[model samples]
Target: MLNAMSFAHTVGNIRHHFPGLPTLLAKATPERSGDILAGIAAKSAEERVAAQCALADLPLQHFLNDQVVPYETDEVTRLIIDTHNAKAFAPVQSLTVGELRNWLLSDEATPERLAALAPGLTPEMAAAVSKLMRLQDLIVAAAKIRVVTRFRTTVGLPGRLSARLQPNHPTDDPAGIAASILDGLLLGSGDAVIGINPAGDSPAVTAHLLRLIDALRQRFSIPIQSCVLAHITTQMAALESGAPVDLIFQSIAGTEAANRSFGINLALLKEANDAGQKLNRGTVGDNVMYFETGQGSALSANAHYGAGGLGVDQQTLEARAYAVARAFSPMLVNTVVGFIGPEYLYNGKQITRAGLEDHFCGKLLGLPMGCDVCYTNHAEADQDDTDALLTLLGAAGVNYIMGVPGADDVMLNYQSTSFHDALYVRRILGLKPAPEFEAWLAGDEYARLMLEATHPERLLTA
Candidate 1:
């Protein structure tokens, strides 16, 4: 029989024992309200540290052997295990999770080496090492690993930061969305994408929005892509009905059951991916998927159980979501960090920490990871919190951030970064928009348009 895996650590006068890998992983995660709500967070600070210590001592190979979610029951787990590159793993095969952290932070872990190691590292291993790292360590280490992707625009380049211009309208009105798009363009946003969350999911509405955005893109000759963030099935229906589709968008989670709750499966995602690629819509390259994930998605769906039917922590589950993103070779992957509200993240500090952790884990896993630096109204956070997080993410080399007008999404009823927020970060960090978009922005017509910019509200009547 295979020996059971257990971990223990001595903290002052008490010794804490964890029964298995899942339990240890849960207890080691930094405090978050979602894990507490799931009844899986560390009981005390000492226990959290003890679990971290034990996790540091555990070898990296244990992750491959001890699947958090069982392979038979979870396709995500199988994908993670089945697709691991043993050849790439050769460099750090014997290192413990703790040593992995040290190596990642060491001078020897150059950008090329880190890029080479990306396919070998699993999400679980990424989460474990992140728990042992400080905030600066997270930033420094993530900066070294660059995972670039391209559609019409290039993203995740070392010195470039992009923005998603979200021109959402409460009624899905074309005029309102057009005005907002004009606002974003004038402010130098929309290099990442001009994606909208439709007020409804009717494929007719989706196709209309797609055509509207595409019309504007063609009218102005902007070198950017557009997406209507409807359900994947709705996008597929629209695509079938001859709507212009640039990138297929979906919300994915870690577990099979959670994904089912969202009415998606791996097969369905693959189908959507294939459809988008067949459109041949991209001008620069063909990485044609956009995925959004959050920490509490699984538990919220009542699908957070791990090996032996124990509750897995939310952060680890969030990391697992990256595996799903990596598999598709997506153009963009972002954690909607605070959009789920305070129930999961609880406060600004927790949201900030989760954003950094998500970025670090995703970049380490070789994905073009961005962040929706945002919060809902009811959350214990304000604009300042998003401002702090946005600046930090820029410094950490985040690929893109959301550009909701005035930092408010009237349709979605949440606060995200504004178009000016993108300008602020780019100015301060010496970062520019994607190359194609930047070239367009520097054109004489763009400068003349900026100087002759009109009131955005007037566009509705015009």
Candidate 2:
């Protein structure tokens, strides 16, 4: 909860950024302010959020001077905004869902800008804004930012399904990592990003894995890049060791403290970005950041409350994390949606819901969205649950999926989609792997397997 004056000052930066807000907010009268606050109590969660956006649009000093109400909880302030600015929202309210969808399809709106504006809209209103556009709109907006990432390899998404090789090992052994990389490539699943999380946590170990992945990529001469998920400092060490690193990877949280706990700061990220840009090894421009995020990281880190104007549901906080990823211009953002387990997500139903929500939010905000399609040992989930999530996201225009050995993560002790799963979805939906890699696979021993995987009837005869 914020005092009227403090809340105003807090999101003042946001207000500053939203053009024409001051003029728009200047028209609210005292009587309407009372009605707006009164009306807010009865609305749904989406409606309440919409109302809050209206209040946030006003000048704090003037709004405080009016002291429309005692300004109790932030929710109160939010509802008051809705009550006060009913007229502004009236136009939104009156627009049919189809009309809003068509408007979004037109050149008049963008996912990035709409994301910035969505916090003030009800989910219904936001849906009205994006119902038809959904994955298609998200893909376009994300590609605009996704294209400039470091080692910018386009995943050939919506056209071709993409998969990553997560050959994580307990010791970060080069042999073990290389074997996993080869396995994924053989399975036609390394098109997303061939990366590892060095559980050993040693910069040297991370560097070794980085070297191993790059070496294999070159040895096979496949069109791919590598990610080593270590602290920026550790990755920098790998870079200093002359490892051919393609992407800078980090696990980001929704708030500043949680992000700091992960040993990341904007300054540190900028330094890594600078280093990655210097590598400049991709045919695409310098979009190089790779981020993995889950819903509970902020709550786990105890940084959920500091989200400022960003609402505090798991979905909102998760989206806020994507906003941070956007700042660094990441090429890929994986919402480890179900990987956090039932402690945060409860059951498969909750997990599935959160996965879809996170995907929609991330893609809507224009991050090259991929889903981990994962679950942990402790989660009340199974292979069937994961398959459902994988299929759902695939249909939703996902950019990539993880390709771990047999869909099992040895180092992290989680269950995620495997190379076969990628094949399953692609074969079912007629999705291809990225063009360059698919072409490479076509020329080799993989040609038969690729063909069989494409048309399973061939497998029965073979």
Candidate 3:
């Protein structure tokens, strides 16, 4: 049996005590408005650092013992425990959380080694180590790990970047969506997947949008996959109606309760994954599920509670969501980082930090991680902030990013990176799109303008 545990640290004259593991995790988290709003943030900077100091000394094995959300009530916790690779974990099993952080930044954590370590590290463990890292640390460590996946094309390969061509429209108008699709394609984007967030959820509407995108792909012989980002059930229904479903899309959260709030569970996700796989649609690879998560989703849903009713911080909950994603061997998993708005992220710095954290944690946990790198009008962030984050993610070797027209989603009413933005990153970072898609960009129809390096406006006119 485990003994009762208490965590405390002294900063200057004050001794701060964290009553429980959840509280320690929460207090140790970097300052974010979401934790502050949830009433779980440290009362002062000193206390926060004290929590961090205390957290650094805690043995890594304790996370395996302490259930932040008890295993019985939360299947996410159960999944973490039941699937953990004990042998893989043995290397770092003896170390404290702080030692894990140092090792991650050390020369030993190569891509292959980190990939092997992925099955060993739990989300709480990843989140714990992340709190002790700076932004550059997050970037350098995340870049060292590679979690590649495949659907119609390869993603997460080193020295390559991909973009999700999000041709979203306010009315789901075919013409407008096609125009945006053309824009992304001409600009050498959409190698990740041409995903559309439908305005309506009706099965018929979803099916129609699926047909539209599939038709475009077939007609052009584009070496890419297409998805209509509807709910899982809606996508399943559309699939049953014989829609050309290439990938199943859903918004997932950390806790079982938060997932329930989203009208999803593990069984349901498995059903959807099975449904997508049975289609036999993917040519290059069979990874067919797509998942999107954000930091504040659990708190926003009022399902962020842990053992003893202490609130789990949003970043930890976000990391937990990655466990859910990894379970399915998904083709794509991205955090819609700033899309949750200022109430959670508050400003540019927080958004940037959260993006790096999400990317780092997701990569650490063996997911093909990406970020939306977006914000709303009400948020205190601007285009410059988005550009900075976009470039940073590029440098971090992020697998994919969203490619919206003009950096704006008319339907979702948010600002994201544009097709031109993808070009800029590729030029600056010496990255290219997926190999299959790059070959297609050199085809007859697009090669004249795209490959020859003629003016972009000429392709626009074409």
Candidate 4:
């Protein structure tokens, strides 16, 4: 039996669960005002304008005026203009998968050199580089088509597929893994999304992420999106022991508990809201993305513990998703709700395609649904499941789907499942096929050479 209620109660219940979450209600004191404006001024001109607009109709003039000073010297403006022109006028060059692979696996990649480069890297940057390299590897392996693949990768696997075709090799350093992925992408295929699970908030993880960011900035100038900060509680612990705070949260436990500790719902809401405001003051509303939190449907589910124990019923899952959505609405514009049940492995077989279409996909899309293709062991089964899943997702108004290639019950031979999945998704979304691999590879090579020639220190120095 389930109790249905209004959106307000749902939000209220969520507040009851997480009592310690911060609130944004504290009056904006004069000092806080200056901090906010200083943060705004540090942003790019475009960002400054956007922030101004956000504050325009609000009681923020005193804060904005006190914090932001007019730029008279025009030095920052000149720098911005010059950087844009440089990129616009830059010539492109071609790179091959084989060439990039050789560079990554070459003897030059000694432990000493890697260590030397480590200090300069950050966890976020490392994560980004890892993704780029993984994409490069997939492109090289397929050698045929140009495609842009975006998904997170786990520690030992190569290719985006969860079901590894090859045995897990022992020598797989996270850094090396990233290097390989980027090499593949540079040789041309498409962009990749790598998941960063920092192992124990060590400086090492932070360094890795930084290096990755640097490499991507040097090569593509693309912004990294879809950050997956899983099991935030454990991540915070690691950071306390010398990990980078920029890449890890300070209090995942307090954050998670506050969300659930009944009496403090309003306070939690305030905290999240305040954090959102701080993030907004610094970037175009676009850059500061936030992932919403919700109770998990089952223990066997893939996400961390705080997300568990919500029950397995579709009604229950949907209810929880909706509740979480309402609670997070004030803070996050983008969210990923798990529509699939926790016992998906056992129950997935019983789930008729229509059940997925109507209940899970349809209902969940009221919030931005994060379709998790959990059972990807068999490609055919996975594809059948996903085909049904995607059709339903498209109908349900889902905008994003997260999955690993060949990781489920489906066996997507390089040509069919992976290629067709990307193709179908692109078609459904009305996106054009990405640029050709040959062209991308050429551009990547030029970028690599340019970095090597002009700012090798960016890679080697912190």
Candidate 5:
């Protein structure tokens, strides 16, 4: 059975972090949150959850309907777009690194502004952006951002690594989902997160999956948590049903209205954070939020980084995505760098450049960065392209990578790192999982089995 009392204690601790949540929860009696108390051992888990919900007077529905900010055109960018002067050059789209450097340094140079146009830049163009920048530029940019790399309020040990166990399926089959999770864990991959984005939008489906994950922990004997990447309201339904949900997952954009359009705002996020804190499923630290972001989420919602609809360069907006993570202690923050295909990157070169650039930027700004070193069928890339980038990112100190079955996201239809790929990186770079998880994986049959398969020399021989 779940520890309701322990959960209550964690919930009480949440107010210490988010000072704004107390008033919304002020009505509870006995100096304890009634919703958290409902989860105490005196009541069966279900009844306690119901009592808690009733006591809190919580509205467990997707209710935010904010507007997306419009993109604004900047004057310098406007003149270039209007005059179309670059089109006269020799296929300006295919410029070399030297050519790109000359172009940026030529007239009214703005490396940051020009860098913003990178999503539309070709691979060659992105390479120039990555290599040619002066250290001062990155130093200047890093100084402006606020970030957090550890669990809330700094409690993580460094020189460790983790991976997101992305167990997803098209039909949302419980057995299939369980099998994939087994695959990832056996390969030593669930350190950062063990979560799923349910293919179906039904609350029942999410509840069913959450229960399956809860039951599996004992059978597998591993310390891990699950995320049903459903609507926050849907997750609330599962939470009401008394399922084991560790973190609330969402894809946040840059603008407020856009986040609301996706049914989340600061207030809603706070409520979810408070509830997760109360649940206390985190094994690494106290953070209970997981977020996935890519460039263009803001514009996709009709919000622009600027006032005149000229979109903000992706780096600025992407950094803004990292900035918001500091609001809550985020356990995992993935910048799906190349998942959007070449439409933004234009080729493998640009895709590779963006992966490294985003990783460096997020890390410098204090985020535990994970790269979805992935590519779609439409992208001008293959496994080899991603493999090279993965090695580089591993060398660059990324906190984690995505662990899917065979590196194939059957549900999302994107190709990423597989369980074996995680093992490969670990073996080559001498990296290990989070300390506690490594202890849990210690001497288990599955770990032995994986060892025999991955490194037969580690096995006892006659």
Candidate 6:
């Protein structure tokens, strides 16, 4: 099903980008090598190399070997290689706009395939897809060239806080809901991070996190590594009050929120930088994480209001959000999570899959792109459509995703499909699926059996 040479070329490209992985592989034992190879086999070659390098403890150059030659090209491999090489070197040399256009209009333009496959596609839909593809191309190009004149890498805290849970009325039993979500995350073999939105200087939320930490320790033997707080002042207070705050950060929802929060954001950053100066003195060490949110779908009332009536047009909103993000780069360079949902509700209207993909590629060049809450319709629904959507998103370079299960009845089933899609993406990215991943999702006895078959060493390495 896969062309080996093309696969090799992609892997080679990944190796080129991250040069510390091969040494890690070389240092692994036979069993570890097998495990690593299995992991790599589960993902795309490029992703496999990326993950390896990302997690590797070695220096960058150790994984790179300029003398390591790739297998010569076949037709498919040649095309992929040319495209890859062109993309890699385009900025330094010459890559014509015409060439880029032709590439999109080619058979590989994802929308063309979707049109042939999805009965829902119309001519207008096709045009939208093309526009998104071009826009993504432009954004990626711009990100590659954008210069950073200022480096205000430190972040600060706000004096207050605010919080909202989606579906407005979250389950009355917040503890039960939290447990279910965390259980799914720990049990599932996917990367998971919890985001806490503690509003109004409430100590209750801090207590809730304390309970979570205890539960994780007692039940799962997992350590609470960090917390991503939406408000800075509350974050610092939480940290001071024995909360395991590994990284200090802030969250921005939309344009108006950006404007309203800009002063606060800057003030907090300046304060944090100032504090770091006093604490660390002459030495420079980063004790905080700074993340800026780009434009996202108005999934909540607050988000809608905060975004200042930015219409639900994906392209326009994305452009505006990107402009703000670029302007705030100096303040947000520590870590920036780009756009969230073009949620399913507005799927055909404001944001299309293609548009989301383009926006992601554009904003997440050097930063992490957090894939916002993944909500699907149901398992009984057309999962192939969902799979196609996931495929498109993955191809556009989404490394972090928030997967919530059982948000609704349909979402429960959809969560299963989401896991499947995640596994598929993992394979495409060259990451190995955990053993018994399917069985665990199926809720089989094998699930518990596989849990008992844990390799603590592997878990430690991971």
| lDDT (tens digit, per residue) of candidate 1 on 1-462 | 123467899988899999878899999999989989998889999899999999999999989889888998999999999999999898999999999999999999999999999999999999999999888999999989888899999998889999999999999998889888888998899999999999999899998888887876775678899999999999999999999999999999999999999999999999999999999999989999999999899999999998888898888889999999989999999999999988799999999999999999999999899999999988899989999999999999999999999998999999999999999999999999999999999897576556545654443432
lDDT of 6 by residue, 1-462 (tens): 112111121244344332222222212211111223223222344454443333332221211211111214112112212323223232212222233334334454343232222221111111122232444553333222221111111111111000011111132234443543344444442222334433334445654553453444334433122343436666666655655444445553323433343434444655644543333311123333435443333223222221112122222223323322332232222112122322323232222343354334333222233334233332122434445444444455343343334323221222322333444565774543222223234554434434743542222211
RMSD to the true structure for each prediction, in A, is: 1.8, 11.0, 3.1, 22.0, 21.5, 20.1
Give lDDT for model 6. 0.32
TM-scores for all predictions: 0.97, 0.70, 0.96, 0.40, 0.64, 0.44
Q: How close to the true structure is residue 132 of candidate 3, measured as C-alpha lDDT?
A: 91
- The segments of candidate 3 whose C-alpha lies over 4 angstroms from its true place after superposition are 1-4, 445-462
Worst 10 residues of 6 by lDDT: 160-169
| Model 6 misplacement above 4 A | 1-174, 189-192, 196-201, 214-224, 228-230, 247-249, 253-257, 261-264, 269-345, 348-350, 354-365, 373-385, 407-421, 427-462
The better-scoring model by lDDT among 2 and 5 is 2
Once fitted onto the true fold, the runs of candidate 5 whose alpha carbons sit more than 4 angstroms away are 1-157, 445-462
Off by over 4 Å in 1: 1-4, 445-462
Which candidate has the top score in lDDT?
1
Residue-level lDDT tens digits of model 4 in 215-239: 5534554322222233334433333
Clashes of each: 0, 8, 0, 69, 11, 18
lDDT of 4 at 125: 17
Model 6, total clashes: 18
- Model 3: per-residue lDDT, tens digit, 102-124? 99999998888999999999999
Q: lDDT of all predictions, in order shown?
A: 0.92, 0.61, 0.91, 0.28, 0.57, 0.32
Clashing pairs in 1: none
Q: Which stretches of candidate 4 lie over 4 Å from their true place?
A: 1-172, 176-194, 198-207, 226-228, 233-314, 329-366, 376-381, 403-420, 427-429, 432-462
Which of candidates 3 and 4 reaches a greater TM-score?
3
lDDT of 4 at 135: 29
